[model samples]
Target: MSNVKNTVIVITGASSGIGAASAIKLASLGGKVVLAARNEEKLKALVAEIRNAGGEASYFVTNVTDKTSLVGLVEFAIKQYGRIDSLVNNAGLMLFSDWKDVVVDDWEKMIDTNIKGYLYAIAAALPQMLEQGHGKILNMSSVAGLHVGGSSGVYSATKFFIRGITESLRKEVGVDSGVQVSMISPGVIDTGWADKVSDAKGREAAKALNEIAITPEQVADAVAYALDQPTNLTINDIVIHPTKQDW
Candidate 1:
């Protein structure tokens, strides 16, 4: 039996990278994927692509950093599919910078999108899932959470926070409720994020680091594997880094 068949799954950051890849993959597996992101154009195109492939999908313009947008996203999914089976929290920011550079603005951006954005989405979705009696939550993190480098202090800290949140959610909610909680951590994915880095030095470093990075689809595969499981079994966490990437 397909664990994702006919299930309604909501994915944040569905406009690009791992989120978009996971949305396509899950939809192909008979999942009704609701794409949520700030980029309406990309989300619409992705939804159209999924539908053209004979997969069920829809788009909802959402700014994960905004609580109201998250609430609306969850509402949109429930309105379209009646219930949410899973949530893929994949939106995040990684503006790497050294401590001496004191890029406080970058730090705040990461905290807002990576940390609070996740919490806001959970706040919007958890209640609905709890009432429905069964659901799954998959948070996207980074290997940086496991080992922080010199320039990724704030970005890594946000992922570490995600790790902590996933554990707490599993223990507090998944222990008894039908809800399941899981996290997928990937390292140095080639998602064009290297060019998006704001700090000049950090951007160059990120580009070099991405030379040994894996593709977003690879991380999406890990996400699928974690979600495609029996209800009685929860794949708690998955760590996926390129074989060439050492430490």
Candidate 2:
């Protein structure tokens, strides 16, 4: 729990953005990373890249929205590394539109990916961590979770769900179960998250905000810091944003 060297960490949403950045960073620190995402090709490529860098890694094609898929991911990680020391629930979708727009499909996608996905991953990983007696659960949330904003009501709600889960789980398992739970809520980051916005207005708004966004690597560095802490220390929550981001 204290060292990253040889620790087996499972990361969902590992295809790109924060997940990919964190995977590369964690692997570089001598952790054995198990990458999972719906994109098998990207996962394979990332695994190859990690190996090329002299780091241990593997991949499992998975959809976090599916409980069975999450279960399979945990099983694959165990098969690859014998045990899991931490899990990074980073798979999420951000679709912004006014409630009046009734972008029901986008709403469902965010709920499934941002909310249900974390629930499924938690259900699958918590038991294994319990059995191991020491583990960490790192969640990726958003600053939106803290405050509602224009055209992002539903997206913000989903992130709020993540915040609630992270906090509740921290209390549920903190120290007593030897499990550490953390939430990293980041502001606008220059990732593909904006591409998921369906409405022109929403996309334009996100684009404008992204003008002062941070990089996924910066968020990955925060993740690395949280995981690098000693066993007795647990970084409960982190809120990171670009210096120019006023809201």
Candidate 3:
């Protein structure tokens, strides 16, 4: 893997789960990581932990769904480190429910965060990356994007959207620009997501699925792999999961 030493990486959703894991891993590798999330306490604590561990780190409270918030995040990172080397569009929501439940609110929440959030982050970071003549953009996705599952149509659809745009951005922009656009689709990660599921039946299924899930750190390994490649070699996509996971 390429060295991320001094590379400025801004990660959304950095308060927990995959986002938090990536920030730690990248920073440990010498990357100057900027953590962005709405939780000030968690973000502050994480920044201190990374600094105490002798790594460069910073925090910015950001709401990914809001374009202005994302713009501010990019500015904060640049002000801290001068330029953005990568942007991890990891801020997302996954609320599962059957179509019959008509959980419009949950579905909208997923769309707003999972879809719009990613796009907004990209919009805020891509320009800086392009201007610098090189950068990496890793979109956190899921296996559900490749295969729809029961009670997760909306969530799955949002991931599908991620896959589609990642590919398009790679072809339309990445081919000519120095930026690398990639996606990492993880399967059944044990990120305490099951505990957050609001749907009754969906929560039960999620907990059962968690029995076979892998850790977010495992997914972070995949992320570091994808981001640490030379701009000449693009790691387009990676699908990571537990070996026991059937689908």
Candidate of highest TM-score: 1
Ranking by lDDT: 1, 3, 2
Backbone collision tally, model 1: 0
Residue pairs with backbone atoms closer than 3 Å in model 1 (clashes): none
- The 10 consecutive residues of candidate 2 with the worst lDDT sum are 1-10
Which model, 1 or 3, shows the larger TM-score? 1
Provide the TM-score for each candidate, comma-separated: 0.99, 0.98, 0.98
What is the C-alpha lDDT profile of model 3 across 36-153, one tens digit per residue? 9999999999999999999999999999879999999999988988999999999888877889999999998999899999989999998898889999999999999999988999
Task: Tell me how candidate 2 scores on lDDT.
Answer: 0.91
Best by lDDT: 1
* Model 1: per-residue Cα lDDT over 181-211, one tens digit each: 9999898899999988899999989999999
lDDT scores in order: 0.93, 0.91, 0.91
How far does residue 69 in candidate 1 sit from its true spot (Å)?
Answer: 0.5
lDDT of 3: 0.91
Predicted structure 2, TM vs. truth: 0.98
**Model 1 residue 195 CA deviation in Å:** 0.6
